[model samples]
Target: MSASNNTADREAKLQRNPHGDFNAVEKSRPEFEEDVEFHYTRTKDIEWVPGSGATSDDWKKHKKIAVDPYAEGRDPLNNYKLLIAGIVPRPIGFVSTESKAGIRNLAPFSYTTFVHHDPPIFCIGFASSVAAAKDTLANIMETGELTINIISEWFVEAANYTATNAPPEISEWDVSGLTPLASEKVKPPHVGESAFSVEAKLVTHHEWISKVTGKANGTLVIVEGVNFHIREDATNESFTTLDPKILKPISRLGGITYGRTTQAFEMLRPSWADEEKREEVKKILEK
Candidate 1:
């Protein structure tokens, strides 16, 4: 069976609410916390030295075991699970693309990251192969353009709904009930709810071949941001930095977990030219 068909078949066997009804499931848990605020706090309250290892004392109490990725009994799914959990707080790329035939797609890809700034390069990892490209990957390859929206806490549920495994004909934008804004360069539109968005063009892509199966496994696409849209209130005069309080970016975690960026602490890079920095490093080295 094809990849899409497999996904459809799997989805078909599932209930709309696998647990109890949506309302019951929601009521069982604490109400969604919406009053969270972004604030700065010190990483550690103690005076530190260069070689001061982890502040926590319990770290050395635990021992780690290693496993071969290709061990006879190990499944590839285990690796996927391990990786997703180990890499905490991944940014979601709420990508929007229009197929050559004009069908629109919107989906959130957690395998997304900004790699460079000189030419403004961003990477999006697609689990499917080029031959079996899904809607977002297919549209990006076909049209060579896409808009990447940053999902904020305000519209995260809407952004996440776009990940539904709907048919190609169905518009995820409509399913998400998100408003779209016309792009300056790309044919695809950007999510208007996004505080920051990037209009990007496909630069190049690479397909990975499985070592065990020797089959096409995945694809990594590189895109160049042609234009950036930042909410005026969320950025400074020069638009160099965005306020985390206003952006309230949502992050992806293991399993069905999502994270918030409501708090942060800043640490300055030490300059060797400063006497205080040199003395600190010198004392650590002497010990």
Candidate 2:
């Protein structure tokens, strides 16, 4: 085989099983436990004052080292791992799309975020360009429509299963056993199990070229959410906000780790117009 063929085989192998041993890894971990209910409580330092800084002073004692992402020995994966680790608790976009031939596709992407609210805009990052796009990105490029489902604790396992690197002929929906609900404006059906989902249309896309190789390394897709489907139990009558307790949204952490929104605290934004709050801020600034 050629050198390129060998590299491709190695990459395919790594993609299929990023973690070397699976059963042994699970065996080393603690048994799965249920009954971890969501807790709503006050902030950690409710009585905190401005300019007090971090709650703990231990952070001050530690010195920091700067990292050059393009260092001689550093590979692209090094930067990828570092960024993902530092950017904690990313929201997963469980995207569903359909090909022109009606082949359904489902996948989860950690590089997804809500960018705007007025026109309901979202950004999804793909590791490849339209020419070499994966199933999800390819489908979106072809049909210009998709459904972005929010993963929850109840169906997290099923949702995660959709990430399996299956062939184009296989539908992730069948593999994950997730039910697809009909969509209004889009041809792609949203996952019925998702409590919160949005039917989105492709607004624009940009292919990012690598500075070193001058090759298309990534694609940034901008989508506009046309319709939102929120579970009745998860939203109030006003439909302004969603209850974290009912939503049970799951977040992607570094590496193979995932996080839950079981505990939360609220903090009100202080206003300068309020004399009392203004004086407090002035005191901190003057100090």
Q: Per-residue lDDT for 95-139 in model 2, tens only?
A: 999999999999999999999998999999987767777789989
lDDT of 1 by residue, 92-158 (tens): 9999999999999999999999999999999999987988898999999988999999999999889
Worst 10 residues of 2 by lDDT: 1-10
Give TM per candidate: 0.92, 0.92
Most accurate candidate by lDDT: 1
Clash list (residue pairs), candidate 2: none
| Model 1 vs truth, CA RMSD | 2.6
Q: Pick the candidate with the highest TM-score.
A: 1
